[model samples]
Target: MSGGEGGEEESLEFTPTWVVAAVCFFIIAISFAVERCIHYGGKLLKKKHQRPLFEALQKVKEELMLLGFISLMLTVLQGTLSKMCISEKFVTNMLPCSISDKHKEESAGNNTATMEHLGGLRRLLSESALSQTAYCASKNKVPFLSIEALHHLHVFIFVLAVVHVSFSVLTVLFGGARIRQWKKWEDAIVQQINDTDPSLGHAVTPIHDHAFIKDHFGGIGVHSSILALMHSFCKQFYGAVTKADYLALRLGFIMTHCKSNPKFNFHKYMMRALEDDFKRVVGISWYLWVFVIVFLLVNVNGWHIYFYMAFIPFILLLAIGTKLEHIISELAHEVVEKHVAIEGDLVVKPSDQHFWFSRPQFALILIHFILFQNAFEIGFFFWIWVQYGFHSCILGKVKYILPRLIIGVFVQVLCSYSTLPLYAIVTQMGTNFKKSIFDEHVQAGILGWRAKVKKKHTLKGSLTKPGSSSTDGSTVRIQLGGITQKDAGEIQPVHD
Candidate 1:
């Protein structure tokens, strides 16, 4: 009879448990791979002078981040499911089986047999402990935040940050270093330019310099060739580098910019040059990064998928914030480059009428966008988890999921509350941009503002006038760059 019962139990379905779990893991892996290949790959290809490769990289990164995000969301959905088991605990927890006596019988005995069964529950609890522990510990003992849930979430997030940040920083550093290396190789060319030039250094784009620098040293260039040298290497079949991994890329850009600023001393440049190192040290020293690291350390006890799901919002929000800053910085650079400086000691001349985008307006838009998206997402997350848990609870197996739902609610609420300050920060950033633009354009020449100046003539018979001088002896002069305040009979070059 025992053998027959055992056979019957063996024949019962196990509910395709691994199928869902495996699919979740596979999807996550694929998502990261795609994102890394595209974003990091494009960045690399662009540096290589391979436009095709660069284009490919961008296409890939976009597709990957999108797909990965979707897949991760789906995996989160799958976590609420359970393997259909015969434990009376499920019946008691889900249905009116609490009073059904069978569950009481199951838990009543302190005998060896009952103790053996109790061990299994303990193990299950340990393995499934995710972010919903408090909920899991309640009278109902819902399986909200299981260890498995948090494990996956934590690992995915950690890897994402580490990979992307590292890749970005390394890319920047490598590009910057390579450019420097190439410069060394081009000693002869540099000398030639130096012998005949005073300002040519300002003109050579780092791209061209890279080639010449390497060519001069007889070293096989990593990115040489008019065509793609290793197209296969450029394309990731499974995994590509992520934004977290692109420290080098970021450093390279910083170094490139630092070199251009005349006001930056060697110490300043050095600090910027070693920014990654500083970030590393600070990351280690700072409590937040350390908290994350330590929180990850708890994974050594085991893994939790819920952590992965929880981390999604955090990572996405931070990435969006960083991307916003990058865009703003780019715009700022353009504004600074073409803006004309005047006597006001500012870049833009006073009385400039037209304006496109002020820094403040642009920043405000971004801040609004981020907060809006965050609000919508947090709301959606809560809605999904709550609905799923409530439905499961009605079915008598709410076990772990219900607790997770409540915890999710609390977390979401807290994050929503925090968004207010974040919104303010973004708004302030926008305001600062607006101020910058206004400052640039302040005191600009206006049609109605009459200039009063005294004109003096030198032996050469050239008229000299001070901008602030009274108009007593001086003729009313409407002046701009390349425009002469001399006789109106003389043609003055109009300024744009």
Candidate 2:
């Protein structure tokens, strides 16, 4: 308790104006560097740079929006609670018993005696929350200049994300890359499939996938990925596959792995499907990907130093777990399934099933956990909001708030983690929006990928008379005026 015991605590409630100006300049410079990196990175990779940049923008905007929006929410919440704790006389009613006398003096309008001796909002918090005060908040403070700067910054970023995501959605609705622009991609991708694996056994013809732009102006990558994941999850709960069927498939997929039926290709493809799904959901612009990852880590430091990180970790872990939860179940089942299908039918188990069998229950469980976690955090935040910090920011009360800009940004960033745009796309352009490798394996059901039968084949022709063989495995023949030569695999060839 070095705080009230008063050894070395000092109020660093403000910073010089020049430092704030420097930080703003730094942000602008960093933004310029980010743009250049994206411009060059896109050029070097031969990838559509616009899409990635747009995706990165989308991430930035959403997080900033969340940071700003949640900050606003916390501010509003704090203000309301603080007002409630203010008695009719304007003296705070949340004061502890030890400070009751001082509060009474202030309430009694003792103009000669300063009420600063009441020790701010420290007197109101529950004992458990109060114990953290001395160790973490000994020199905690609120910087007016930094808070003002952060307020403006958060607003700018929030509005930007809201506008960016909105504009991207609008463009998608209007459509970006027209028929001529995107048709080539469809043909080229399908042509690649034809060239690589002709016997893949399914209709992989390029569906009319709508492209938002020739490059990535809109959040196409992120939007498409989001739509695909949602569709996949929704399919598991109802539709053709029941919850039971979904869980059963997850259960059976793992337990059915046996020595006799080593279907390595099936297992490989199934896991690859999961990997693709993961990429589809999370694959965004590398710039955005890197930025969020870095900030998420930075948020860890913020939590260690002051306040809390809200539901960031829980939200993130759940998001990832939702994508890959089936692996553990499937792999475990396969190990057991191998023995059952091979040597031991001794232990009763669900019969082996489709490679594409899904586990919606796993998804449901995760959703429930996330919901509960969110509810608990929200409840606690509300509780603390009402119980303490009558005149200061929530951080200034419950958590340390020294060095205004750092704490302000850190808290806002923490708020940002709690906000995410799970469903970014609202415009529906039919089946073209979603493409999943996971769905390709279901060969018989309603959503299965049935094989496409080929209509034309190569015609055989009558053989020609033999010609002289050349030294290099070519055929040389004497023509009316000169010699002619053709390579071994050439249909038409070298002239002499």
Candidate 3:
């Protein structure tokens, strides 16, 4: 009967209990092969100067990192599963062949009973491995994570991995596209400026020096072509080298101009605002980046899941706030411009327009909201660090996710409730956009950018003077920025 039972047990364990080890090894082998091929392939194509190959190398690195991340998750899942399904407390459960009996057997030099005990253990393991369905189908207490939870987490990780890979790939493709577009735009602008008569360009499209182009449109050949274009498309792509450049693409109400001063080139103010905000954001962003690197590398499953819960709101709010600013820039540019200023000397008129989004008060309100929101992000990691135990494998800690989220709500609400002398801060002073205030108050306090602020040069005896753009018979003296634009082109569209 025992022999028959042994045969049945052997039949039950048709597959190896710890086959995941072999799977891990196989995955490693495959990754290694792929990495080697990519690295070598890039080297081979270096002589041809195929720019795409460089990006491919970068993609390979990101892919390998993600693969390792996925592999680590799978390994953990497999190890826990194997333990729950096939392993048993063999030494403790050897009561039938008690320690005394084993000693006696050893003293008498009788090996038959000992061999039988070992054989029985093997059969037991085989039986357990084959009956793995029973473990999953019922409550499993062996692993820290319940079988249901483990599989659920595994599924989530799989989906997350897929999404992550897709995002990376899309970013690369989009980056390439953005590189092409940005280059094309630069070339067009250069051509337009070169072809444009300087006298006309000054009054309408200001023909600026190399410094102007360098300051504004990330001047041609100024940045590393390969590096700058790597992920130039998306400012949101955290690891992108050109994230600052992407951020610099927009300089909204930060480039505020007093409607009173025509000498105040919106383009010049635009450049200054761009530099200030870009620097401030880049400075502050490194902290978040460091946190991200640590967070990802640590990969604590419960903590990560908890983070995702809160981070979703953070990311969503960020995107929404950005969109709101863009809309405000378009619809209510005048109000924000008057309320926000870059110069210390220029006194702007109090923005009377109240209903729309261009209100200075609203801009400042949004700015503070964003500040608090960012502060919350920095605080979250610390909160997680303090509240939760870092024993990453303990899935029972997943229960804390919801409770902490509630606490976080309380934290946010409390923060909002506790009011400060914040009104003073939002009150747009002439010295608002200066560098000294950047880190202290306005970390990139850009609302949105103004496209084509047409400074209308209203001069003395302008309408009375006989000047017809249609006739082109006589030069018109429209005093602009102290420079006489002699032949003013067709009365250009003006910005109030």
Candidate achieving the largest lDDT: 3
TM-score of each: 0.22, 0.26, 0.31
Q: Once model 1 is optimally superposed onto the true structure by TM-score, how far is the C-alpha of residue 323 displaced, in angstroms?
A: 14
Q: For candidate 2, report its TM-score.
A: 0.26
| TM-score winner, 1 or 2 | 2
Best-performing candidate as measured by TM-score: 3
* For every candidate, C-alpha RMSD to the true structure in Å: 22.6, 23.0, 22.3
Clash pairs for candidate 3: 251-449, 252-448, 252-449, 253-448
Query: Which 10 consecutive positions of candidate 3 have the poorest summed lDDT?
Result: 446-455
Cα lDDT of model 1 by residue, 1-496, tens digit: 2253323222225536787679889989986786666667767755764443344344334434544574566467645532212333553343212353444444654468645654654344443443244445543455533445444453444343333333333333443343343333234433443576554444323321322122211233333332222321221211122221122222232233332422222222222223322122112123333544554444321144333444444544444334333332232233344543312111111111111253323333332233223332334334433332233221233543444445444433322332222222222222111111111123233223333232232322344344533233334354421122334342211111
- Deviation of model 1 at 165, angstroms: 4.1
Model 2: lDDT equals 0.32
